[model samples]
Target chain A: MGFLFEQDNFALFRDGFLQTIELSALSALLALLLGTLLAAFRVSPVPVLRAFGTAWVTLFRNTPLTLLFFAVTFGLPPLGVHFSHLVFAVLALGGYTASFVCEVIRSGINTVPLGQAEAARSLGMTFGQTLTLVVLPQAARTVLAPMSSVFIALPRNSAIAGAFSVGELYSAQQTFSERGYSIFAIFFWVACAYLLISATVATFFRFLESRLAVVR
Target chain B: MSILNRPASAGVLYDAPGPKARARYRLFGVLSVLGILGLLWYVFAALDANGQFDPDLWDPFQYNFVQQMILDGLLATLKAFGLAAAFSLTLGALLAAGQLSDHKPVRWACTGIVQFFRAMPLLILIVALYYAFFAKQSMWALVIGLTLYNGAVQAEIIRSGVNAVPRGQGEAAYAIGMRKTQVMASILVPQAVRSMLPSMIGQLVVTLKDTSLGLIITYQELLFVGKKIASQPMNAAGFPYIPVVLVIGPIYIAMCLLLTALARWIEARGRRGANRRTSPAA
Candidate 1:
């Protein structure tokens, strides 16, 4: 415990903590954007796009995040695509997490009653109009809880990025253990840092859910 | 209309296409198909130019030792998954029982344990376990970490499943001469297991995948083996990372998909069985 407060050791843990948050935030944004697109594609009138969306979700959802990280870290460089390690971590985590997010959003969309869409169609709303104006807004409400779970899992999954040299909290653990510090104390703090992040994310989502709650 | 063939959720998003709409969709579809094909071709060309498509890169997989290594890795992964699955389910059941206990302290303690473990990132937990207790035993570290985290998740699943049973079921059992344990064993658990099975299997898939984290601790699971293979530079072009991914990736996908399919099959059968049981009584 005393070693935790040592100047150099504290900096190492702090930097690792910040890097974890940075990776999670960036990847969450990417997952949301890509996932929304996939969800829309899955529900759209275009057969090809729907097929593509389904394939993307299935392929990604079944694959382990670690393997995806390996592919991005090792496989991509050979194909002439290059990026920073952080960027690679983001791509892998975001891409994998997006599959889950897509399912959450699509299921959310499904939970919106069919009558709502039919009414919009009766008003001669186009597909885009019905989806954006009528369907998606309603879906957003039901989607929040599951969507939160998905997002909460994102930071936890980003811990894998540490193994790939993204210098996150897990990497902090690696560093500390190698330096011969007390493993239990170091782990306790690292676990606390993770729990804090998860709790904060959980709280934010609960707030959002409350704000978005419909009285119906 | 063709909308009748699609799921209500998908179909309701748009009306059946009229002639103009149909024409527009056809053109958009064609363009999107062309775009996807173009992207695929670009990727293929890039990989080909980089000599990733060379047959030599795949040579290591053909060797007897390499194949045996993969087989051993697969067995090791399954062995860990088997132990973790058993332990997690047992732990989940105990924790769920404790959470649902009559004593307030017991319930609170169980809830705290579940929440604490659930909130921890599993990799961190595994690594911590590796260093703290199982420094020389990576498999136990992986298994115990998986069990703790997944058991917490499974506890929630089981608790919710039990609660989801209509309150009348338990009341009626108690209204008879049934003891608490008897009521739970005969009435609540059997019913809850039906609903909980799918999610339990789903978690098992997750446990299977998380086994790959063993690679970090130098546990020789399938992914670890694959990584080891990929790191060995057999050809001048590069390490066979792509080849290893192609080989090992499908094994994982196939295993998960098979489990998912099995769950669906069992669920369908359960529904049919329930229908048969009620239909005759009706």
Candidate 2:
């Protein structure tokens, strides 16, 4: 609490906290797209696609995010692929989170009636066309809340960026600690920053959820 | 106009994987998979080429040091996870009861703890614990952090499970003069336990994986062992980092999958038990 009044460490907070938001927003977008596609494949009639999707989700979801981040930073270099720490952080966070999002979307997809797909096909729509025009829209509507939760979850998950030495919010906090900043103040502030971002994202999602629910 | 011409064949929905779409999907799938394999090959090849993968490069795995480190790390990981899991579940039950309690402060406090902890990242908690409490050799840091965060999650899960049980049963229990604790422990929890068994196992899976965070605090867990081994693999193999990752990754995967399969089995047995009890009702 006393550290809140200390103006020196405020610079770290401004930069590091903003980076966290940026990283989270990017990863959330990437994860949503990747997850939606994977969930689609998981439920697709193609057995191979379904198997591929399941394996991907299970592998990523089950592994600790720290190890995954480590794998990205340390594992890829030998293969002649080098990502900046920021890129590694986003890719690992996005890729890992996409797995969880896939499960959420799949659950939403399951809730959708079989008759809708059947009805769309009866209208002579291609599988892709029907999925895009009919199934996805409704599924998206149903998943609004869960997806919003996932979005809120992004900052928490982004904590792994700390491991990459990516200088994100948590990492910056660590630097301040090393510099002899009060541990309690730094952590308490980190917790508050997390709470603020989470509440904002959650409230925004609730608004979107109600909006979609009304349309339904 | 677009809504009227839909095909009427139910078979088309399941059966008709168009030839072009099927072929294209397969081609893309095969190519992507092959690309992954090729990537792996390139990794190993480069490591081999650099003489970094030498079999005799460094002797970190010499009789005592590496093995002892791994054993100690594994023990710490297990200890932390065990304590955290037990504490979290107990805390979760208490929190759940409070959330369901008639008292507003109790409910609000429980909810606040759950929300606040759930919102804070587990890694942040671990680091905070490190700085705040255990500055040195802090297994307690890891354990407490994991417990605080995971306990909140478990509380929510248990509460949801209990809520899923119809309301009439609770009212009936109250009518019979059963105490609140007795009602919760006897009727509500057992039923909720059966319903939430899968989720509990899922959280356990999460707890197991999170043990790797012990690495940040230098807690010498499995990944820590792998890292040490990779940097200094004995014999002629150069730094076997990727091999270490391959080894560790699958072990983690195997453990989680085994837990998942076990959860599935328990859920099946639970279903049978549920059916047997409810048979008369049915």
Candidate 3:
């Protein structure tokens, strides 16, 4: 525990914590954007686009995050693609998480009453207009809780990036362990950091949920 | 669910297209197909330029020793998954029981354990356990870590399943002079198991995927073996990283898909059996 207060060790820990936060934040944004696109594709009238979306979801959802990490880290360079470790980590985590986010959004869209879309259509609105203006707004409320879970999972999944040389909290755990610090103390602080992230995300979602909440 | 099988709610998003709309859709479809094909071709060209499609890079997988190593790794992955699945299910059951206990302290303690473990990143837990206790036994470290995290998840599922059982069912048991333990064992659990089976199996798929994490600690599971194979450079084709991913990635995907299919199958059967029981009674 005393080692936690040491200037150098504390710096390492803070950097790792910040790295984890950056990874989670960047990937969360990517996931939301890509996932929303995938969800739209899934529900659109275009068969090819729908097929493409389904394939993306199935492939990402079924594959292990570690395998995805390895593919990004080792496999992509062979194919003439290159990026920094952090970028690769973000791409992999965001791509993988997008599948889950797509599912949650699609389910949320399902919860929107059929009459809402029907009313929009009867008023001469186009499919795009009905979806963007009518369906998605209603879906957003229901999507909040599940979306939070997905975002909360982002930080946890970011831990895997540490192994792929992304310098996150889990990597910090390894460094601390190697430096001969008490394993329990190191894990304790690390766990607290993760808990704090989870709690913060959960609270943010709860706040959003309340603001958008509609009385049945 | 497969995307081809559209859900009932899908019809809400759009009505049947009129002639003009249908023509527009056809045009859009063709453009999208062309776009996808162009993307695929680009990827193929890139891989080809790098000699990733060379037969030499894939040749290592043909050897008997290499095949045996993959088999051993797969078996080890399954072994870890089996142990973790069994232990986690048992732990989940106990914790669920504890959470539902009439004793307030027991319930609070169980809730704390579940919540803490649930929030903990599993990789962190596994690594911590490896360093703190199972330093030499990486397999146990992975197994225990998976057990703790998944057990908490399963406990919530089980508790929810039990609670979802109708109040009248449990009350009837109590009204019939059944003891608390007897009511739970004979009434709540039997019903809850039916509802819990799908999610439990889903968690098992998660556990199987997580066995790959054993590679981080040098557990020599399938992914670890794949990594080992990939790291060794073959003649002129550089490391066989792409080949390894192509081969090993599908195995993980197939296993998870199979588990998911099994869960759906079991759930369907349970629902059918349930209908039969109710219809006969009616």
Candidate 4:
């Protein structure tokens, strides 16, 4: 445990922890936003929008995030598309995570009641207005739990960003290994760090759920 | 405008597009196609600018050595997944039994392990297992780490699956002089498998895909092989990054899709059998 407090280990681990947070947070947000768009497309009036959304979901969800990371990190550079490692990693994470989030949100939207949308239309609300004001708000409430799951999964998944040299928490393992520290202690501490993160996020979400649980 | 299709809508959610709306959708559709084509053109230009389209760079994949390496990598990946899957399922079953134990302390310990593992990232777990136990044996580390994390998840699945069995079924098993273990084996486990097979297979897909994470530990998995191929210039081009990824991406996607399809088939079979076993009322 004292090794965790050692100056070199402390700094590297701290940076790694912070990097993990940044990677997950930004990418999760991107996934959520893009997912919402895809979900909307899934149920949109336009057949083409619906098809495109479905296609996007199938394409991304079927593909593994590791492969997507490779595609962005290795594949895109050849195509003259360039970004910082973190940005590219985030894009990959966001794209992959979006497929899942989209499915979750679309299911949430389904639970909003077909009658609700029909009523919104009957009340003279246009498609966009009905979705923005009525459909999505209710869907948002229903999907909070799954959405949180997706968010939690983002951080866990972001560990792979280390492969792309994103300098996140898992990357700290390489540092510890290189530094001649006991692999046990280094791993023990890293596991504890991840456990702390996941546990904290989970508890926070649990607290929110209990505080404002949807009856359904 | 017949009431049959509903006066306003063609679907359950929204009104069918009127002529103007249809025209607009067509416009958007055309724009979408144009946009995709434009993006494709841009990517092509960018790739061509970097000599990524060079025929010479890709021709080497026709050789035996590279092909054998990839197949070997694939087999190694499957080997790891198989070990991890079996161990995790067995571990999951034990932990789930412990979690559902009548003894409070046993239950508590199981709960703690599952929660800790579930929350812990797989990468950290692999790294920890590598350093603490496996030492330089990266394969065991990857396998064990995957097992712990996935086993924790599978515990939840099993616990829920068991609990999902009708209370009457377990009580009846007990009434028939079956012990707890006998009841779990004879009654609950079978039903639970029927219900949980899809999810179990889903987890297997995750497990299969997760084997890719071994590359970080320098395990010679498929992704690692792909990386080696991608990085080697070997010819005039700097690296065949695009070609390697293009080749590898479809292979992974195919495997996942196949796994998912297999799960669906099993689920459908389960459902049909269930429907047959239960009366039509069910």
Candidate 5:
């Protein structure tokens, strides 16, 4: 503990923490959007589209995210399609996560009653209009909690960025340890960073939940 | 309103997709097409630029070094996974039972174990355990770390599965003079097992993937072998990095797919039995 104070690399720690936040934000946003779209495809009227979406989710959901990261980082470069490790990390994380998110969103959509869609159709709305007008709102309520937890998962997984030398919180701590910082102190700080981020997000989700309850 | 019969709202949350949704779909379709085309173009360009598509550079199965390392790594990985899977399921059940215990100490102790272990990243746990305990460490640390973390997750899954089996069923069992332990052993455990099977298998998939983290502590897992292979400079491609990844990717995918299929089979069988018991005879 005293070592942390004496070393006083709080500035470096803060910058590393900020990079983690940036990486999380970008990946999460990209994942949610891609996931929602894939969820739509999974529940599409067309059988082939649904099958394709299911296969995509099944493949990604089954394979490990680390393996996927390795694939993107190592597999692409030899084909003369080199990406910065950071870019590849983000794409891999976002892409793999979106597959799980798609499953969550599809379940959310399923939770919404069929009557809502029928009612929308009775209003002479197109299928897309009916879905927009009726189904997604209710599904959103049901999925909010799980979705928030998935967001929490995103940051925890951001630690994998360290493998590629992305200089996130975990990588920072790894560097500190290599530089003769006490291993315990470095790890303790890393854990604290992860906890802080996760707890903040969990609190925000709880707030969102209560607010949604009030609306209901 | 009932869950199924509620009227839809007009807000974005309530509303489904409309013309804008169709347009968005079309846009994504076009984009996907372009993306695939671009990938194909890149592949061709790489081949043309390199003026050769060399197979030997990347085929680890063809080389004695790569094959030996991967085979050894594969066995080590399986060893860790097998031990962890058994430990996790057993430990998970015990912890799950403790969490649901009437006694406060047991519940608190289990909760603390579960939360702390689950919250810490698996890599850190592996490293910590390797350093802090087990003289040789070997596969034992990796197994213990995986069990500690995944067992916690499995405990939660089992607890929830058991809790979901209605309060009335437990009450009914107790009223029939069945002891608490008996009720849990005979009724709750069986029912929860069925409901929890898929999730447990899903956790196992996670455990299998995590075996790769063994690379950090030099446990010689598949990823470790891949890394070793890539660090060498024996291939004609000059950049055998991509080939190593491509070679290894399928191996991981194959293992995971097998687990997934097994889960689906068990789940199907369980559903059939459940349905047979519940439905009226023909």
Candidate 6:
């Protein structure tokens, strides 16, 4: 257990922790952007966009994230499409999570009063304008809490990147646990680190919600 | 994604396209279709060049031995899922009850356990359990690991469901001189079970899929079996990567869809008021 905090081991944990954070942040950001686009497409009048968005969600969301990683890591690289294992992992995570974010955002969009869009329409706002200016802001406000769950989930899911040999916390735990220390101790400490990350994301979003909350 | 039954209010963002807008939409549709086609073509061509489409690579599944292995693997996978789902649900129900307990220590203890398990990653939980706790018996490790992590998730679902029960219902139970346990068992849990049935089933779906994480520790589940099949030297196609994915992928999608279909059936039963008898307190 003491070996966990030894100078060399400590650096491994530090790097792994930072990498986990980076992976989560990058994946969450990408998922948010992709999800928002899919949400917009879902509500669009264009039949094609709506179909594509539906296909994206159905195909990716139902498949396990592990399989997605398997496909990206194994399937693509053999076809002469090479990327860093981390990059493929990020794509896999973002791709799967975006489907969830799309659902959460769509539910939020559905919550916005229909009359608000009607009112925006009467004021000469185009469909795009109504969505971007009136609906999205309201949807964004409503989805912060749900979206926070998605982001919190992102870091935890980042652990799967270890399957691809990505040097994240899970991989670090694997390494340390292999070094003859108690595996439970290694997991306990890494889980504590993850708990801190989850709590921070949850707490920060809570603060943001309070600050941005609007009275009806 | 779009196959979801659209709620009646789904199209709130915009109206139907008018004549000119319809023409523009059709053009956009054509371009999008072409883009998708081109991407698919690129993948097809590249994979062909890489020999991923060799029929010889896929022919191994025709053998009894290969087929039996996959069948056994699927059963093993289901067994893990079944155990995890049962234990996790039981654990979740108990933890939820404790979190809602009248005693502060019990409530706090349950809450702490739930949060700790929820915060931990499933991979680490499974791996740690495999290596540290039950190194000799990998099945117990996987099952218990899944139970702890997913039990935490199910605890939230159960807790929220119980909390969502109407306050007046509990009050009425108490007015009838019902004890805390009785009120919870009869009044709150009954209603909560029906209302939260969908989410509970959703969690089960996740649990079933997550059993594949056993692959990380050589648990010989479906995904791991698929990996075993995929990695075999029976084919000269340099690892039948695409062929393996093509076969194994649909099996998973089918199972997940089956879970979803079951959820829908249960939901519809509730909607039809067919299960009202289950909630005797109501």
Measured against the true two-chain complex, the DockQ scores of the candidates, in the order shown, are 0.69, 0.49, 0.76, 0.52, 0.28, 0.63
Clash counts for the predictions, in order: 0, 19, 0, 0, 10, 3
- Expressed as tens digits, the lDDT of each residue in A62-149 for candidate 1 is 8889999999999999998999999999999999999999999999998888899999999999989998999999999999999988
Query: Proportion of native contacts found in each model?
Result: 0.79, 0.51, 0.80, 0.56, 0.21, 0.63
Q: Write the per-residue lDDT of candidate 5 for residues B70-89, one digit (tens) a residue.
A: 88888888888999999999
Top candidate (lDDT): 3
For model 6, give the interface RMSD.
2.3
Q: Model 6, A32-59: lDDT tens per residue?
A: 8999999888877666677889889878
lDDT of 4 by residue, B216-273 (tens): 7788999899888877785676787788877887888788889999999988887774
Candidate 2 off by > 4 Å: A5-7, A214-216, B1-13, B16-68, B233-238, B273-282
Winner on lDDT between 4 and 5 is 4
lDDT agreement with native, every candidate: 0.91, 0.80, 0.93, 0.84, 0.77, 0.86
Clashing pairs in 4: none
Give the alpha carbon lDDT tens digit for every residue of B34-65 in model 3.
99999999988988899999999999999999
Global lDDT of model 1: 0.91
Residues A1-216, model 3: lDDT tens digits: 788998598999999999999999999999999999999999988888889999999899999999999999998887778899999999999999999999999999999988899999899888799899999999999999879978988899899999999998999999999989999999999999999999999999999999999997
Q: Would you estimate the TM-scores of all the predictions?
A: 0.97, 0.89, 0.97, 0.91, 0.87, 0.95
Q: Looking at model 5 chain A, which ten-residue stretch has the lowest summed lDDT?
A: A43-52
> Local error of candidate 2 at B179, Å?
3.2
Better of 3 and 4 by DockQ: 3
For candidate 4, the lDDT comes to 0.84
Q: Which of 1 and 2 is ahead in DockQ?
A: 1
- Return the candidate ranking by DockQ, descending: 3, 1, 6, 4, 2, 5
Q: Which stretches of candidate 6 lie over 4 Å from their true place?
A: B1-7, B273-282
Stretches > 4 Å off in candidate 1? B1-5, B273-282
